[model samples]
Target: MPYALYYWPTIQGRGEFVRLALEEAGVPYDDVARGPEPDGGVPAMLALIDGDSVPHPPFAPPFLRAGRLLIGQTATILLFLGDRHGLAPKTESGRLWVHQIQLTLADLVVEAHDTHHPIASSLYYEDQKPEAARRAESFRNERIPKFLGWCETVLERSGGPWLGGRRVTYADLSLFQAVEGLRFAFPKTMKRQERKSPRVVALRDAVAARPRIAAYLASERRIPFNQMGIFRHYPELDP
Candidate 1:
């Protein structure tokens, strides 16, 4: 059966990470929320989420359905897909190491989202402009460099090409997504930040150049960056 991926239609958010992995794995999957009704759409996702038929229920968007198993949490979903698709290492230690990198990218994603919604997700950016500015300023100056620098450090220590040394792990794809979002959310900041993170930037470039990834990125399936998504571009917030 094709993997069923449930996420918001409009926003890439955390779901994009899973999408990238699926795309890279060259596997067929239905982006449930983006499809037509009956078998697809947000209602279908909600049915699975809110319904009691399934033994496991997801708390929010970006869950995956693989046959009998229902997987939630972006990292956990990637872990499953990684093992199934050779997107992670063969050994337990290597797999855990890649998982650790993905979790770290998740941390950076949370920080990036919190920059615009520092006060609360329930509150709009307008409601938290001042707080967002304060948060964004710090993120631009400190967090982005720190997180990206750490990525560069990891890449350097891991030899050359790919985060987990020779293999192309799911974490590599995720790091590319993180950098892509950061570029969209903070283009100006990333311009300077990229100078210090050449390997990180290069990895992002390399990921983009992959045949499937490149096609996926160019296709209509790849949602454009917008204000509503996790990576929103507000001049005030970015300024």
Candidate 2:
């Protein structure tokens, strides 16, 4: 059976990470919320999180269903999908390294989300604007460089275009998503770091060039980064 991806409908959110990988690998997947019915979009997603179905439920959006396996956590789901779809390296060590990069990317993602909502996830950005300002400053000065530097190190150590070296993997997909998110959220910061992270940028461009990825990005299914998603484009937040 084909995999089923459960995620919020409107925003790309964490689910986009999984979507990018699937699209890149040309794997078949059904984005459940994108189906028919009222509230089948966001409300269905909310219900799954609120319901008692999976014994090991996800703490947030972007879970996957593959036969007997029900996997949550964006990184975990990607790792599984990558391996199953031949997008991952064959060696155990290589797979471990890929997972490491994915987890680090996940951390960067969380920080990016917090840049626009530093105080509480439940609260509106308007209510947390002051805190968001402070967090965004920290993100621009500290977090962005730190994360970019680590990715630079990974690229340097890997010795080329992809995170796992030579071949594209889940790590590269996640990193592409990270770069896209950061570009959406911190265009100025990304511009400054782009020169310093050539390998990272090359990988991003490579992922973007893949036929499936290129097509998906151009398609309407790909949501534009907005103020509501993890990567919010606030003019004041840039640079």
Candidate 3:
């Protein structure tokens, strides 16, 4: 059966990472909140989350319901899907390496999210813009380069068109998502250093150009990035 992806309806947010892999692999799954059927929208997502159908419930968005398995956490869900599907490398070492990359990507994502809400996730950006600004500065000046540099090193060592050598793995797709999110949120930083991260940028572009991914990107199904969600682009944050 196709997986049921539970997440917010409007923002790409964390769900975009899962969406990228599913789209690239051309996997048939319902993006639960964004589905065309009326029974498959936000209400459906809420019901699933609120229901007692499963013993282990996901704590947050971007969870996947595949058969009897109910999985949460972006990295964990991706790792599970990557292994069950062909999106991960077959070898144990390769799979472990991909999981490592995915986990690191998850860390980068949380940091990116916190840049706009450094004080607290529950607080509004307006409520903590000053703290957010402070965090953004550090992120732009230090965290961004450090994370990107590690990814660059990974790419360099992998000798890849993809993170896992020749094949397109979940790590590569997640990396593309991360690069996309960062570029959206930190365009100025990205423009300044993207050339230095050639392989990472290339992977982003390649993921974008994949037939299904490209189509989804162009389609109405793909949600646009906004001020809310993990990667918010503030002009001041960039400059």
Candidate 4:
């Protein structure tokens, strides 16, 4: 049976992380929400969240329904897929480390999203422009370097072109998404910091060059980054 992935049809968001892992592994899966409604579109995704058909329900979108199992949360889903698809290390300690890195990346994702939605997700970016400006300043000047620097350190420690030493892992894919999103949302900031994180930038480029990933990226299956997604581009916030 094909794996069923449920996420918003428009934006990549957190689901992109899971999608990257599946694509990199050459795993076959259905992007449920993107299909027609009769098949499994937005309604089907909402049903999974609201319906009582399953014993376990996800609190949000970007959940995966695999056979009899329903899994939620981006990091948890990646951990499950990583182990199953060989996107993570075989050893327990190594798996845990990859999960740890994924969770940290998740944190960074939230922070990046919050830069544009600093006041509240409910409020429009225009309504909270002042607050967002303040938030973006700190994020651009301090947080970006801190997170990217840490990733560079990890790559240096691994002594690799990939995050999991010699092998590519879900963590590497997630980092690639992060770099892409950051570049879209804060091109100026990322361009300035890219010099400091050569290994991290190289890893992003390396992931992009992978055959499956490269194809996925070029294909229509991979959604383009837009303002509605976690990483939104606003000229003022980035400046």
lDDT of each: 0.93, 0.85, 0.86, 0.93
Q: Give per-model TM-scores.
A: 0.98, 0.94, 0.94, 0.98
User: In model 4, what is the error at residue 180, expressed in angstroms?
Assistant: 0.2
Better of 1 and 2 by TM-score: 1
lDDT of 4 by residue, 135-158 (tens): 999999999999999999999998
TM-score of 4: 0.98
Estimate, for each residue in 1-239, the C-alpha lDDT of model 2 and write its tens digit.
Answer: 38878887778889999999889878787788887766456666667678877577678778887887778899889888888887789999998888988898889999999988888899998889888888899998898888888998989998887888999898887888889989988899889989888878988999999899999999987988887788889878884
TM-score of 1: 0.98
- Model 1 clash pairs are none
Ranking by lDDT: 1, 4, 3, 2
Residue range 1-239, candidate 1, lDDT tens digits: 48989999999999999999999999999898899998888999899889977688899888998987899999999999999999999999999999999999999999999999998999998999989999999999999989999999999999959999998989999999999999999999999899899999889999999999999999999999899989889887666
Which run of 10 residues does model 4 get worst, by summed lDDT? 47-56
Evaluate residue 78 in candidate 1 and report its C-alpha lDDT on the 0 to 100 scale: 95
Q: lDDT winner between 1 and 3, please give it.
A: 1
Candidate 2: residue 180 Cα off by (Å): 1.1
- Per candidate, the number of residue pairs that clash is 0, 0, 0, 0
